[model samples]
Target: MTEGLLTAKAVMERLSQSGQRVVTAESCTGGLVSALLVHHAGASDCVEGAFVTYSNQLKHSALDVRDETLARFGAVSAETVTEMAEGALRAAARATVAVSVSGIAGPGGGSDEKPVGLVWFGLAVNGKKTKAVSQNFEGSRTEIRWQAALYALQLIAGYDE
Candidate 1:
C-alpha cells in the first residue's frame, strides 16, 4: 500500500494533467486497481470506469473477453487479459488508455502451470500497441492482490514512456 501511494498518485496526476482518462478491467484483483486509483484525490478527472469481472461469464459479458480465448487460455492468461483491456477501451470509448488484470490468488487453485499469485496484466495506451506481462508473487491472498494492484498502477504510470 505504501509503495503504491506515490505511483498511484503520480499516475492519476499525470493522466489528469495530460487530459487522458483511464479505464480498468479486473478479475482476480477484483477492482483493486480501480480502488487504488480512486483512493487518491482528483482521480475522478482521470478515471473513466472500471469493471470487476470476477467470473468468466462477466469477463466475457462485461469486458467482451472472447469465449474462445477463455476456453483456450482460461481466465488467467495473457490472451484473456489483453482482450479484457481492449474490450474495456472499446466499450468505454472515452478512455484513451486501459489496464486489465487477471490471476489466481488463493490458498487453493494453484496448478503446476499457473500457480497461485500468478497474475497477467495488460496495458493499452494511446491506441498504439498493447503490452502484457506475467508476474508471480508469494504471499497470502490479500498480499498477492495488493501486489497485483501495485503492479497495475506501475504499469499505468509507465504507459506514457
Candidate 2:
C-alpha cells in the first residue's frame, strides 16, 4: 500500500476506536485525500464527507471562506486552508476532525513567491480550533499530489493528540 493509504487507514482505525469522525477539504490534491479515506472498507463509519473546492469561488460559496481573505492571501495561503478546515468541520457536524489542503501543483501557476508544488494544509478538531502549515515540495505534479495526500493523512492521524 502507498504510505498515504496506510496512514489514512491507520487514522480511520484510530478515529473509529475513539468514536470520532473526519471530513476533508481538498484543492490541489483534488479529492485524493477523501478518496483514500473511503477506499478502505467500512470507512463510512468514520468519514463524514469531502468538499472539493477547486476554484476560489467554490471555496467562498461552499466553505464560507471570506472573499477578502482569498483576495488578500490567495487560495494557497495558510489562511485559506485554515478556513477550509473550519468550514469542513462546520459542514460535517458529526466529524471530530477536518483536514484541508490547497496548493499549486503544476508545471505552471508558479511565482517567485509561491512556486509550483507549494502546498498548505490545515487541521481542525472538535473545539472549533484550527492550525495551518505550509510545505514546498519538489517534483512533478503527480509526485507533489502524492506527497500532499501523504502529509494530509499524517496530519489527520495526529490531530486528536
Candidate 3:
C-alpha cells in the first residue's frame, strides 16, 4: 500500500468501528480509491465496492447519473457528482455512505471555465443530505490524480469540510 492507501486504511478502520460501509465511484482517478480501500486488512468491514465510470455513458449506466444532468452540468460538475453519490448509495445495497469523484486530469482538454486539475467530489451518508465540493490542484496528471485520490480518502475519513 502507498501513502494514500495508508490513509485509506485508517479511514477504513474508523468506518469499521462505526459500523459504516462505503461505496466509491471514480472517474479521472480510475479505481484508485477502491484499490486503496481494499488494500488493507478488514476491508470487507467498510468497503462495499467501487464503480470506475471513466466515460459519461458508464457514469449514467452504472452510477445512474442522468443524461440530462450530465448534459446540463457536465461530468465534472457538482450537480453530476451529487447525483452520482446518491446513485451509488442506492447501488451498493450494504453501504450507508458513498463518495464520488469526477475531474479532468490531462495535458489537454481543459477550458477556462473548468481547467485541468479541477475536481468535484460528492459525499452522501444514507438518510442525510448529499454534499458536493469542487477543488483545483496544481500538478502533472499523475500528481493531480494522487491529490484527488487522497482527498477522497480524507473525505471518507471526515477530515475534510
TM per model? 0.96, 0.97, 0.96
> How would you encode candidate 1's per-residue C-alpha lDDT over 47-75 as one tens digit per residue?
99998999999999988889999999999
Clashes of each: 0, 0, 0
How would you encode candidate 2's per-residue C-alpha lDDT over 85-123 as one tens digit per residue?
A: 999899888988999999999999999999999999999
lDDT of 3 by residue, 59-140 (tens): 9999899999999989999999999999999999999889999998987878999999999999999877899998899899
Q: How close is candidate 1 to the true structure, as a TM-score?
A: 0.96
RMSD of 1: 1.0
The residue ranges of model 1 lying beyond 4 angstroms of the native Cα positions read none
Point out the worst 10-residue segment of candidate 1 by lDDT: 1-10
lDDT of 2 at 129: 68
Candidate 3 TM-score, C-alpha based: 0.96
Report lDDT per candidate. 0.91, 0.92, 0.91
- Clash pairs, model 1 backbone: none
The candidate that wins on lDDT is: 2
